[model samples]
Target: MFGESSGRWLDSELWHACAGSMVQMPPLNSKVLYFPQGHAEHAHGGKVDFTTRIPSFIPCWLSGLKYMADSDTDEVFVKLSLTPLTQENTNALLMDLEDGGDDCGNNNGGVVEGGNQEKPASFAKTLTQSDANNGGGFSVPRYCAETIFPRLDYSADPPVQNIVAKDVHGNCWKFRHIYRGTPRRHLLTTGWSNFVSQKKLVAGDSIVFLRAKDGDLCVGIRRAKKVAVGGGEVSVSSVVEAVSCGVNGRPFEVVYYPRGSSPEFCVKASVVRDAMKVRWCSGMRFKMPFETEDSSRISWFMGTISSVQLLDPIHWPNSPWRLLQVVWDEPELLQHVKCKT
Candidate 1:
């Protein structure tokens, strides 16, 4: 009688085990595409119409993951995804989408060859004493100045320009940029102190700047990582790293992935708080993108929360970054595994 059995139950068990294995596998650092409005066919079509398009998908790097506690269960049920590139940094990206056009006017009143485009530069620099003190200037690296800033008019004295910088909140800050001193360097004077004060930036935090396609400057902040000394609980800090200018020039925090092998993505404090406010329960369906071997491709997986794990006594009881075990469907993966979402 055992031999005559169809063995359907055994097959089901094996299938679930395989799905669980896939979910338990650690994710790697790779590029993935994010479609804000689910998936659309026109996204893959050539000559995408930006006008009628609600919002196009963006490609970004996946940095890491952090677990958060479920408010209902008071256990970790959600994982916070992290990435360095956020929508705030999309100005440069959007410009690239515009067929290599340089709207930033040059001295010749003409677009420079290759659209005067330079690869976006990113680096970490500690705030100096002058930057931390009341001094109204922030020193910029010479390489950053030359690459990220508009081409300077050396003929003009001081080589100064009034720049309108957009913050993570899409707030426009008018600042003065001048190339001055004996050897000649780049500095953000006048409004520098105000920005520092408003953002509560200190001597240790790092600043990130990017030049958009329209020659407008954008800025982001990166706080130094904190150690959990003797604690295993994962805590989400309210740190703002990068800012992206959304539709109608609304500035919002750009998710920042720090420079390291971490799986944590730096998101706005408000985002974390908002997510935690939602009640997540076991058996609830969860969907998120997963990277394929190509890195350029992205696939979505749907899973149900199997169990919520509470933090150890040594861990922070209130921390949101906790652990959740999930079980995914198999046949769905076979059908949609290669499709972009």
Candidate 2:
């Protein structure tokens, strides 16, 4: 069923390369493709592997290619071309897409990359209304920033920072920051980290932490919007649904499986929040016991946070990331959604 699955499995690595940049010239004309995973039962032979599952090769003419991190392989590749536009314009295009949930070829309310020559005020108005009714807005309570960023080494490794803010309608909006630095892994401050544990974050889930109108930290989990497994087109409505339908309460995991290179070894994971130490800042450390399958049974691994990078807001300025903790879970599932046992 893996090969015949309708969606594409975007290389997480491509997400890293494309991170913080805006107005990407994708290798393909902003279209999705379908590729097969070597596992599941439909490979050319009964056996398959990551190298065997790399998506069809598409090269970018304008954008340079980069990977998410060292361990990433070609299977994580995403089609993106480098653009010659300013970081601001590039960011604008990206922010526009993420905000409006529209894709490159969207013409109904057609917004062009490197276009928008109209008055700045008009453009600003259009941009602000993009997600107005959707409860998207950006404003960080000074307490939230002081409480989170500094702890994440924002003072030292500052990359772009972003926060989720809300409007009178109880709608949450994301605010992103643009900063200078080589990208680093972002950490959730003590409060938000606890919040994640409270929410049981999975791979595709997006968590938004905001200062509630009542002046408290609140979190929202937006699942990673899925496209076709290997590659296929996704609709804007689907993206909006991903954001709008985000779970707004604490979550618990039913099973836990660490990330792996093989398929047979994979298992699902479920996490329920446990109150640990409170009031820790970003980058603060905590210990958790994780169980993984070595061969047949499970083994325990002591986990520590290696690093944390605040998602660049300029790119996704109005999206949320307050309690966004990107910690390493060995039994990490390849995708965020839980698979059936």
Q: What is the C-alpha lDDT of each candidate?
A: 0.43, 0.27
> How high is the lDDT of residue 71 in model 1?
21
Candidate 2 similarity to native, TM-score = 0.19
- The candidate maximizing TM-score is 1
**What is candidate 1's lDDT per residue for 71-97, written digit by digit as tens?**
211111123233434555455544443
lDDT of 2: 0.27
For each candidate in turn, the TM-score is: 0.37, 0.19
Question: Which regions of candidate 1 are displaced past 4 Å?
Answer: 1-119, 213-215, 225-341
Expressed as tens digits, the lDDT of each residue in 137-163 for candidate 2 is 322333334543223334644544555
